[model samples]
Target chain A: MRKQKRGKRTAQEKANARKNITKAIWRHRELYLFMLPAIIVLLIFSYGPMYGLVMAFQDVKIGVPILQNKFVGLRHFNRFFSSMWFGVTVRNTVLISLLMHIVCWPVPLFLALLLHNCVNTKLKKTAQNFSYLPHLLSVVIVVNIVRLLCDGQSGLINILLREFGKDSISFFGDPKWVYPMFVLSGIWQNAGYDAIIYLGALSAVSEELEDAARIDGAGKLKCIWHIQIPCILPTIVILLILNMGQMFVIGADKMLLLQTDLNIARSEIIDTYVYKTGIGGSQYGFASAVGIFQNIINLGLVVLTNRIAKRLTDVSLF
Target chain B: MKRISGERAVNMVIDVLLVLVAIVSIYPIWYVLIASVSSPMEIAAGRVLFWPKGLNLAAYRKLFEMPQIWMGYKNSILYTSGAVLLDLAVMVPCGFAMAQRTLPGRKFLNTMFVITMYFSGGMIPKFLIVNAMGMLNSPLAFIIPGCVNVYNLILLRNYFESSIPESLLDAARVDGASFTRFFAMIALPLATPIIAIIALFSITTHWNAYLGAQLYLYDPKLFTLQQVINNILSRTSSMLREDISIEELTRITLETNLQKYAVVIVACIPLVIAYPFVQRYFVKGVMVGAVKG
Candidate 1:
């Protein structure tokens, strides 16, 4: 009787384990179905192109197939590293991105806070709508507007300067002003749009906490500083980390639009260099090499920042 | 007491400062509008200040006179409309699908999209794919590849998850409503904010896209407004710098800059007019997706 009971118990346990496995599979089936399209799209568009990164190591000719091209392993990399413009481009890209992060990143946060604090909802909404107007304008249009305003000979800025008996400043042509112009124009174009995210964050701040702070004799600024800023710190940190991760990618389109011969020294980042060399010069191999190099730096930065963020804040982009 | 009055004064000062900053931010665009309407000679001589020196509709007339500009405008409108439609078709359904927690592999799908947000195949690979697809010189080149933006997808997905209650979906299911019926009747209405956000984003992106057109479009007739304006500006600038006659150069430069701004005005005006209607949706949509999520 004991042997028979043991046999039945063992069989039941085996059957139960099999049933559990089946249930687990069933539970996850819908998720897999939902994810399939996105995965397929990513594989085709993103991962499929990853194979072309091999061209960076090749001495590619336009007519010849990519695979048929001669393998000149590290030759492009070596050339790029040794190039005179490499250090300058890297410095310009990093500095400009860093400066933009410092100046542009906070403007939205401040704007959002101010908007949040405003007593009149209508006024806040009006300000937001007006401010966000520039975000929709094309980069080309924005650049043209900038050029119109700052043109030395015919620009509105020079016209204004002349009224004060000052010489017209060649803002676009001068190298010193290029970075500032890029950063400022960037801030103007983006601040309102970015503020939407912060405004979203502010709305999430528990009203009860603000009430408590107020009852505790915390003034508006103190309540905001103590209650509000801390609540949004996670969002800010994540944004900061993400910004750092994208440090290698200065907005190439804007830079290309803004490029002038005089400012080329300061403006030629990796992306613009890739465009000028690869597309303009038809040196696809060299451009691919530069792109791959930038990608590597970007990947490293993202991973590093993500790791640091995870450790410090318990939040990571991943 | 006195401190409260002092704080009010400070607030007033701050408010004025904010208004000044806002004006500064918007001044360049204002300057462009003024310059576009002012006499070219006055613009060149730096005499035109805050307003138009002589309001001229000549630039607008000149732009309209060019058949190329009209063609460009038509192409841009078609491209933007088509792209937005395609983007919406894919994005709306995809977002709805993602909101189903019972759906299999949701986390994995989310991770896949997030990965794409940072890394792309870069331009050459994308070009190669488009070339391989035989989309080169075709409007499909502009439409198909960027059919859905991952950021928009995620945002829309978040909106669906937050705004649409599961009990409502359950009630629909109990009433024998098909998945399509449920999505169409219940989810779609609730998704208006995200739909509007996506529409605005997609329209602006498609309208502003110059690089895609530059890459795949070869036919002059197919050139978008931005491309046409770009060519006009460069050609006119080159003509002016060359040994062209001053009379001809002056005539061309004035016409080109004026028409360029006119093009800008035309491209911007429609969207700017449409923006206010959609702006309310944007804040709510953003809060739902980004903040609450």
Candidate 2:
């Protein structure tokens, strides 16, 4: 059997394999040297932490080696599964993320198409500058800006509201207004920046196609619906799939910053919950269990969404 | 008379709407700018609108008076520049090496880099690792743990392969140049565009990061501009929530509305100034990174 397998391999193939293995080493030695420090950094920081994930099953603490702790199977998992905060957190995260993703996804695409057809290039460039400006600011700055503008007493919006004989809205402090503020900030900070990818795709679209549609007696809106939408549909679908992959991955940092005690009911998310329990409370195993649970769900959603997109639109991340 | 086509009419309407949005988009920054110099009493009473009620330098003066803000700026500048250098040092070579088809197991290394982007050990494990290594509370904690972003690495890798011609590399090899010599002398010079783009990204990320400072740094001296801004914002909002009487407003709170706005602007000044310059490169970098990878 071994002789038969060996006989199947041509002499040229054997020699090429040897060359690939042996000659590549000396020739690419410097390349390997270049990659060495980075590889070592990744091994220590990225890969090492992944290995350290095993502490989810162990009752471990910082300053001690993770392996020293006794592994109690499913204990942390059981605590998380039955915890009171679990359902609240998952529901809040899904509700907020789903609403933001669906609502905010198409604004950029719409804006890009509109901007592309705009007659005044100067105005278009000026608008582009304004739109993407917020993307550069950190979440804290954005939230603070929102706070200043939407402040119930001195805020510009409330001042305008009071002028019209309407009650001032408590945007940051009230539980009801939290979601609106979150979604609005999402649109403001991201919509203009997010539109660039679609803009890139849209700018590449052939003018001939649009002209042909117009020649066919189609109006502006009709041409957009028929020609423009379908042309960028693949990019749209691919982006949608990518967005779905991150469905469970809520913004822990932003949420933590935006959370007020008054709006805590609506604000708490899975990532924040984990951060509190794991780092804040020092319940390492419990936090890791929650983190693992979340990551697994995110992975499943991404794979499932990718498969669906592949079937429906013939576009997928993979 | 030239006739206006229905298409032209529709385009006009879209233009009007886009202009309105552009105004809304830019107004937040502009509003804060005018509000920061307005009298505190006017701001607190919701009287300041469209422009400053009275031109005053009190808020900006008060903000500068706080020594902590200066310290925050100093620390942030050091951390941002340091982190940028480290990021470029590690990520560029790694990206170049990973892109080289001549390297053994390039595919495997690429996959290894990409996987980290999707799946990580989450915050706790990473924190534990950082803490165990005694990097907690240290500037190295911020610089070392996140020196290389996998997405940026992948983007750089893609750029290297797509932009750098293979024949140029071959010519260098034909001249009997070692890989390091060729990379340093020729490749590095040609790779300036990507290096600039990555450096900008590194500067933005390191400068803006606050959660790290919140979690890791116990010493007040090590706090970044973002952390100090966060504290200022939180304290101001809580004070606003209390809603003191007009007579008490002057004495009840130390943070004037002008000071609050002034401080926000101060925290954002460095980044805001740099943003427009790099905006074009930023868009290109993001588009390539997003669409391809």
Give each model's whole-structure lDDT: 0.77, 0.82
Stretches of candidate 1 exceeding 4 Å from the true structure = A1-39, A62-66, A119-125, A203-220, B44-47, B165-186, B240-255
lDDT of 1 by residue, B168-279 (tens): 8879878988667778888998888679888978888889987778878989988987788666654437634577788987777676777666666766676678777877
The A-chain TM-scores of all the candidates are 0.86, 0.90
Q: Alpha-carbon error at B143 in model 2, in Å? A: 0.7
Fnat for the candidates in order: 0.30, 0.60
Worst lDDT 10-window in candidate 2 chain B = B249-258
Each model's RMSD to truth, in Å? 4.4, 3.0
Summarize candidate 1's per-residue lDDT along A1-318 as a digit string, tens digits: 144555557777778766876786575454455445655666777777775588888887766776998999999899999999899889888889888876568888988887777665666666777787788788877877777667666566777688789998988678888888888888888888889998878888999999997677666777778999999998888788778888777756778888888888888888888777876787877788888888888888899998998899887778
lDDT of 1: 0.77
Model 2 lDDT at residue B224: 88
